[model samples]
Target: MLSARQRQLDRVRTFLFGSRTHYGAVFTVFLYALLIAIGFVYLYPLLFMFVTSIKSPEDLLNPMVQWVPTQIYTENYAKAYRVLNYPQTLTASVVMSVVPSALQVAVASLVGYGLARYRFPGKGLVLALVLATFIIPPQNTVIPQMLTYKQYGLLGSPLSLFLPAAFGQGFKSAIFILVFYQTFLTLPKVLEEAARLDGASDLRIFLTIALPAAVPAFIVLFVFSVVWYWNETFLTVIFLEGGVTTLPMQLSKFAQAYENLYPPGVVNIFDRLNEAIKMAGTFLNILPLLVMYFILQRWFVESIERTGIAGE
Candidate 1:
């Protein structure tokens, strides 16, 4: 009898929330349309770049804006390479961005694990400090960090860039810590209790039980790490010197070089080259991230749902 009544309730609720209620279906359609509009707004530039990168110089310079390339000259990518300083700059960026980011994620996860799992006297205080750090502007700390790195004989080294990451000691590291803490807080308590009852040590519980449950949070952290590191322009500039410059630094260099070599609107291939090269550089810089996001968007979305907010 209860089951039949519950079924009727479900049907009524669905009907009300679906098309039966005033303008329910219209709101749903509007939401979907809004989402599509936003998606196009975000992705159109990347799409434009993919097409623009392959266009012949003549086609790109054509009087009217053509959405599609007339003849896809694949060689423009190679030509753009000369101005981009492709191979070396690419390698430098990968090392500068990727290495430190991985370190930050590791350190943040480990620190968060300890804080979440272990009962400490001043856990709240420590976490408050992390939150406080987040509120502080990074620009204020950059000079001090530079001075500290210089004192440690680590100046101008890649280690200088990654050392703070290793220690969970950078601007973004604080954000990671808060995120990990929040996610870890949402994990079921019984899992830890069960592990303890089974003669599992704290270390074993954290390593085997807690960490396994936090995979969603880990994925989110991984995404943040890779994207933040890849896009970080300021840290790359201050810590790194000429030989160890990142793509951001290299982009700035190219901009200066291009300006010095040619006046704007001169119409030479080399002169107009700067415009396309900038676009190509942006394309190359963003493509890897776009690919990663789309490929893992399902995981990203699933993780977001599990990240405590929905359940809360």
Candidate 2:
């Protein structure tokens, strides 16, 4: 018994210095620590926003109150809602984000499926062009796009944005196409062949088998598309202009509105119009995204794993 115990201790010491087991454990610990640090870095800003948003004017003014507020200021949310014109902006944001996401998802999926399953002349060139297009920053084309939209009197219309996405030219659309392409490429050829042997038409097989099998890809793309569209400010300003207002746009306008509402001449305004209110508006702007991520985080993880299988 003593010899067996002595051998186990010696093995453990040896493993710690020279074996994969201890090295793996140490590497995992380091990775976990690194992830936790990164998580904190990303989350700290959000945490500050929530905390600052819930603070009352008095609590905000008090430098001593860093983490906890003396009193919760529920009114900040009400003020933010009013400032943002929440109902109207929320509706516009939903339309802007969801509509483009749906259109882009459908179009990109078809394009990706075709690229992955079929081979033809110029296929490689087409894919290369797509990837190259992604590298060309949107800023270069903004002038031409604006001029074209202006020529058609679509400067302030959502259609200006929608039409581009309908044609599979939406924001970061090439990336979504690539994602779907990679996912489709990972599917087993036997399943497709089996379906074909059963007299399944190409379209029917794609809709019934290929698409259904790539649910994770769809979910991942949809979520990412929504996020990109939702956070988009530059394109929204250029295309929709004043015609549509989303939460992020609303937040940008808040500072101007604040200065106008409480000019430098105003008295006792320092306590009311502070960073807390600005942060409150920011919190409201991002709340929907936070809710969405929490709800679909599981699917996101699965998608990450599945997306990597193509390279493997």
Model 1: how far is 108 from its true place, Å? 1.7
Question: Which candidate leads the pack in lDDT?
Answer: 2
lDDT of 2 by residue, 1-312 (tens): 569889998777765554644464556678899999999999999999999999988887789999999988887777777778889999999999999999999999999999999989999998998888789988899989999989989888889888989988999988988888888887887889899999999999899999989887787788889999999999898888768888888888997766665565764664356778889889988988989899888878787776673432
**lDDT of model number 1:** 0.74
lDDT of model 2 at position 214: 89
**Model 2 off-target regions past 4 Å?**
1-35, 194-200, 259-272, 309-312
lDDT (Cα, tens digit) per residue for candidate 1, span 11-49: 676655665445455567888899999999988987777
**Candidate 2 Cα deviation (angstroms), residue 56:** 1.5
**lDDT by candidate, in order shown:** 0.74, 0.85
What TM-score does model 2 achieve against the real structure?
0.87
How many clashing pairs in candidate 1? Answer: 0
